[model samples]
Target: MSELDALRERVVALERENDELRTPKRRRIRGRSVIGAVLLVLAVVLAPVAAMGTWARLQLVETESFVATFAPLASDPDVQDFVAEQVSAAIDEQVDVSAVVGEVFDGIRSLGLPPRADTALTLLEGPAADGAISLIDGVVHDVVRSEQFADIWTQSLRFTHDRATAILQNAPGTAVQLSDDGAVTIELGVVIERVKQAMSERGIGLADVIPEIDRSIPIAQADSLALVRTVYQVADIGGFWLPWLVVALVVAGVLLMRDRPRAVLWSSAAIALVFLLLSAGLGIGRGVFLRAVSPEIMSAAAATALFEQLTSLLAGTIAAIALIGVLAAMWAWLAGSSRAAAGFRGLVDSGFSAVRGAAERRGLTTGAFGRGIDRFRGPIFIAAVVVVTVLLIASRPVSFGSVIGAGVGLLVVAVLVELLRRPSEPKEMDVDPSADAATSTAQDPVSAPDAVS
Candidate 1:
């Protein structure tokens, strides 16, 4: 009984030791999971911020990109009409055609006209003012719609890019000014000058009396200029580095996970969701912007055109990122050990096998070349994916079309590789009868002795 008790105690001690040994490992695994979860969440949360930052950086830091983005707004009919209306209003306000017409009538009356003639001339004042306003409106519309105006628009944007950057940075700017009310105004004084020139060329004497007008037209407005500035500053500061940081976080998080493929799938899906929300948020923001901008400041159509044009690049970037995330998630799922993934892979393999077999039946075998490719098939496919990924990343201003094109190209390459690969022939096994009999004798010693007898 004493010996049995001692034995039982020994067994208990061993069990306790085993539990102690596993406890630390379990704790470490839990800690890693927690850390990885935190990192993945941070990455998903920062993806939209990184995207916006990249856009802000590109628009503010690269003058050429900024010009390219907004230069086309010049040709938009709504924009042209807006400019025409604003310039015509400015000219009418400054020139005072009614007052000018009245003065002309008064001058004629002062030239010794009879009472009846003076009364008739006074009656013509209203018609004269209306005709002069109509003439100014027509000339302004013509100038705003002309090709010369588009050239001037592009040049003005290029020249004002720096000042625009400064304004967004919360610094003083003259050519492009941000008002206290969050109105972004660009000096249309240049457009006014063009109008004056056009009117003069049309042989209108009143154009000489149109004094140089300095007017600024509101292009965009925000709810709070300070908020806009703050956002701009943050985006500019993080633009170049934030995207890379998000990538690093996501990679680190995936590596730390025990189920790396599942982690990649979840993380990429989360990223896609975030970007989709961002795209939706942009759509919602357009509505809010149109509502907030009063008609007195800018017409709805004009504001809508401006908002869409300015955000087109940002929209494209968001779409591209979301698409990449979706692709990555699909890749992760396909590479996983799940039943669906396995079934899909099997289907693809069988299809490829059938194609290869049909080709071989037609004497299209690649012989040794096909076998060699089969040996390196996995690495070749991985290289193709890597090349497409690199090209997608290196392409400036990545768009949906480019991403889809690269994906299609990769699929084609993968299909070609699969078709080109040929399995090597199996080697025949050499049978050794004596060796097999010796092994059987070792397994059945009794049977071996009976055979010897």
Candidate 2:
């Protein structure tokens, strides 16, 4: 068993033993442990969810993360496509390419080449329409994908988030305006004007036809404020402390159990359940949010995108926590006293020992340094495993490449650490057969002193 696992098992046993000694079973309140376990279950269930909510709020409410959060959307194909459609529709209103086509047809008909010329021109309308829409699509694409668009996107997000935060605090903000009916809005007038100017600069010739485009999209409505207020209150009071409290409660609950490893497994299972619950809650909350707002207030795509972006990191974190719990439980199970667990451990030890033997035979394991490696092998191995797991989980987003890389790196470290262990030399027998026989004769003389012998 690992030092940590052993220590925990001992602690759990000692704590329970101490409690029992202090109070007789008959004198103790009925079902006290059951009630305590129930509370612990609740803690395991709620803590992770509360932590995820806190993260979502921090990301949404903070200025830097808020801007960074939506910056990538400017580059998203769908988002760019949406922007292009809206801009193209607004610009198409003023350009009237069909009018230009009509004028050309009138001029061509005046040539008097054929009576069916107008009908022929009408046949060209589909191609002309395609060409016009395609041209608008190209111009909009370039504008939306530009660095200028990125800056605008960042600024707009910051303004909107700031406005939302202000409204939450009842403070002043310009970009975030509210209707008399309490519909929240972030005006996109500047963004539309910029796109028009960009299209003109790109020599699309439709700049003159691009009418003034200014618009406001609703982000939230008045009725959702009650829900917002609840979250705001959590951010105000719980903040980062909620996660810590969760840890304390979970630890206390685990210690109350006489089998800490089993408790760990149970807690982990409960945490997974919480993850499922939180995911369901997010879906339900999205519906609630939508129902509370006017459908015309915002684009469905935009609303979904906002909710997704806000929850992405939180979801990833929850997944990581669940993964950690599963790994921890598995590790604890490996240390069980069951026959299968023992066999598995023995196999692992034998594999390690074989590797060590090969290294020693190759002269890689020798001297005081090798001895030092043997002394701290367990701790060093644990530290390396922890470092690798944490780096994969916390430092960067995990990908296939990253997982393979981390696995290879950990294997190399383990091999290198094992290579530094000095193999033990077999001890010679303390007494030869001849010496034992001589010692027996001496013992006969000594036995005479003990009369009964």
Give the TM-score of each candidate. 0.80, 0.61
Clashes per prediction? 0, 0
Largest lDDT belongs to which candidate? Answer: 1
Query: What are the per-model C-alpha RMSD values against the true structure?
Result: 7.1, 10.7
| Total backbone clashes of candidate 1, pairs 3 or more residues apart or in separate chains | 0
Q: Candidate 1's residue-wise lDDT over 303-378, tens digit each?
A: 8988898899889989988998898899899989999999999999999999999999999998899998999987
Candidate 1 structure lDDT: 0.82
Task: Give me the candidate number with maximum TM-score.
Answer: 1
Task: Report how far residue 401 has shifted in candidate 2, in Å.
Answer: 9.5
